[model samples]
Target: MDGRVPAALVEETGRWTFGVEPLPEAADTAARLRRVAGLVLALERPDPALDELLGALDRAERALSRRVPADPAPRVGPAADGDGRAYVDHSRHIGAFNACFPEYTIDVDGSRATGTVNFPVVYEGPPGLVHGGFLALFFDAAIQHHNCEVGEAGKTAGLELRYRRPTPLLTDLSFELTRTVEGTRIHSAGRLLSGDVVLCDARVDAARGQRSRLPAVSPRRVP
Candidate 1:
């Protein structure tokens, strides 16, 4: 069983502290994930992606460390118990979200907003298609904007999606959110557009729930 381990680790690192040994005799899917993890751990030479991953992790650590943990609410905002809506600036939030989905952008229309996301091979899953899980995330984010018209201070209660076609890798896909209602329950619809073709449609149901009892931030007025 030790021989099943890769030479890169056994020869260089000598012993790996994987915490748990692989039980390949288990289900094939889990078995395969473990095998990949072993190979990944055993690599000695730094792959191009390794640097990107390390950089991302480092940035994430710094961001989390910088987050204010002492406050029950935002650092420079209204009290959480207030009726203020909880929201980040569309541009600021979109820029941050771009860290993961590089090709995403915010489309502002007055107070309403929509976002467009384009995925490439770096996030590819199927042979020539984007992963369903990833597609769900895009839909969730796009539809969440529909809540902008809602009381502007609630969390999502449910999300529904219907994928119409294989979201092709490297395609210029756009997720357009159409706001429906914006009150006690925020309702919005989302469509995945590959040019003019519709690939998926989604809906979000957001309610006046609280991640905290604290009031959410409202956008600052331009000086």
Candidate 2:
């Protein structure tokens, strides 16, 4: 079983202990779907046939629902929680509803990890800038990716961010994450940049063996 979560390798530097792990692949379907979502977000003048297109999509959704009835949520035991195979690649799994993930590819090495993303219109909040929330999300994901590879799977306990400059939309931004471990916690620092210009910087604290909060409720079934 592919580790449901990511795993990291510890490196002995003769000075400090650190970790590095391979980056996850960007799934083809997830990438394409994100592009589709971007186009939808950028749409301006409505197409004359949009109504018909919506109707056809609705019919297709209903047909699919009939063929594949909803299944109960799978039960997870405590032992199963720590199994790497139980984790899913955050950047690749389309199941997470994160359409912006396909915008980046992460690189990892013995001491550090870096990611490059091209922000599209779908992530815009200000006139020409990427959304602040998305900036936080990117930093969180980057920090978690680093920890998941080197430490036990964990969740963010705290994040502190500073937006130095506006992160422009439809432009490439670079991010770097460096980590330090103290007992059961992982501390990471990163910067989001556009070439030499610093767009944002973040510090994150992650606690090992943590799980995210449960979903508030099941999503409304389609059709």
Candidate 3:
């Protein structure tokens, strides 16, 4: 297929609807926090002013820690919150802020998907290049995201990546993917590019299953 996203899919613009709505307040807070973390990573040297900021953050962390105990359940699947909705968390791809997750944006149409991402310094591994592990994680998220958008997704069975060139950090990069299905196996192939140069590529394999078929999350008890 051509490298361009089909005109049909381009016309269907908007965020994918497979996931439950993100909490607007939480999402905003996360975005702010992520920005701060990125800035901290970009710092050239220690600053005395950070001491006061760190102290305040410490207290805030302690206070917030008491409000929510950690739940070990996975966040993606059927009735993840016991609300009877099939939810797919796309926080890594779009919306919601996760300091550890590499941020990116994606657009999907039928069995093909495309997107752009800018790796921050925090994800750097080799000098100015992004960590190889993060690229693998990004591919997994993008492929699963495409699956969910097309209304068929499941657990990642396997993922393989080939690095052709070092992916630089703090620069805009683009990627494209095409998916094919065979029986219960879903196969997706993707390429990460800097202009016409392919920096890396991946093939992800997943098992096709219905959201209702996924194991249910145990309901949390009210205190």
Q: Per model, how many backbone clashes are there?
A: 3, 9, 0
Which runs of model 2 end up more than 4 angstroms from their true locations? 1-26, 67-74, 78-97, 100-102, 210-223
Can you give the TM-score per candidate against the true fold?
0.51, 0.69, 0.78
Highest TM-score model number = 3
Lowest summed lDDT window (length 10), candidate 1: 2-11
Model 2 lDDT-worst window of ten: 14-23
In model 2, the Cα lDDT at residue 157 comes to: 90
Off by over 4 Å in 3: 1-20, 70-95, 217-223
**Candidate 1's C-alpha lDDT?**
0.52
Give the Cα lDDT of each candidate. Answer: 0.52, 0.61, 0.72
Residue 90 lDDT in candidate 1:
34
For model 1, the stretches where C-alpha displacement exceeds 4 angstroms are 1-98, 101-103, 110-115, 149-153, 209-223
Kindly list the per-residue Cα lDDT of model 3 for residues 7-30, writing each as its tens digit.
122115432233334455666776
As a TM-score, model 1 comes out at: 0.51
Better of 1 and 2 by TM-score: 2
Local accuracy of candidate 1 as per-residue lDDT tens digits, 70-126: 333432233433333223333123323233433366674533566677665545677
